[model samples]
Target: MSRWRRLWSVPLLVLTLCVAGCAITVPSDPQGTLDRARGGELRAGASASGELVTVDGSDVGGSLAGIVEEFADSIDAKVVWTVGSEEDLVDGLEGGDLDLAIGGMTDATPWSQSVGVTRGYAGVPGARGPVVVLLPMGENAWQAAIEAYLDREVTR
Candidate 1:
């Protein structure tokens, strides 16, 4: 091949690889545990009080709580519900006292670097459920995964 052709090929290949690598991986059992509220208990913390309570009363575990419970049942993952303020939930998740946390689409930088937030709820501002991921303090892969999952779930 011509030198110019080879040079172009290299750039094209790199571009393709980058694009492919950007694709997020959706977990196999993304909705299974939340779809059914199964036996495997997923300790989830949430922040619901006052007006937010009446608005998202059933969403005490956060908006995703209901869906998580549904999937948990399907996969035998029982979700142990924990109610608390948003700050408390974030603290709990960071402290490892809770497996997962539920909260508004506020700042999720501290808890999990890989945080995902969705918009579009029935009576809320945006999405129904948003998810966030906690990266290794300086990475985005984990966040990508959670975003992909949340993207899929939010649309559903």
Candidate 2:
């Protein structure tokens, strides 16, 4: 083989090995729940309009809000709602004003990976219901809680 080809092959083989060795193994239940008392309070933020209202009189647009509420209830945690634009809510979480936030806008954004969202729940209408869950970065406990909650609800 040519010297150039041989050199390229070595790097390619090393890259492939690294990728294979580093592959992440996801849990069977992607949404794993933590104990509520142990889980602590979960502060969630969301964008709202006058047209959308929660059971508590908080403004939360779309059916996504209802699902959020249900999940929060199931988890036995209070959802601290921050009603405003998507940017406002995201800013609130980033600024340490909130623990978690959920919105449709976020589901399509670059931040989705950090937020940890699940799309297209049944009976939500449209192509799929938009639901995004924004969790604190590096908070593995919260991630597990949210993931477990989602797996339970989505399965139902």
Strongest candidate by TM-score: 2
TM-score on alpha carbons, each prediction: 0.45, 0.55
Candidate 2 wrong stretches, greater than 4 Å: 1-41, 49-57, 113-130
lDDT, residue 142, model 2? 60
Give me the overall lDDT of model 1: 0.47
Best by lDDT: 2
TM-score, candidate number 1: 0.45
Q: What is the lDDT of residue 145 in candidate 2?
A: 62
Model 2 lDDT per residue over 1-156, tens place: 999999899899999998887755433222322343233555667655222333345745456566666767776766667776666766765565666665554246677554444432343422143445665455556666666666666631
What tens digits encode model 1's per-residue C-alpha lDDT throughout 12-62?
A: 999999889776544333333232333456666665533323224444533
- lDDT of candidate 2 at residue 119, scale 0 to 100: 38
Report model 2's TM-score to 2 decimal places.
0.55
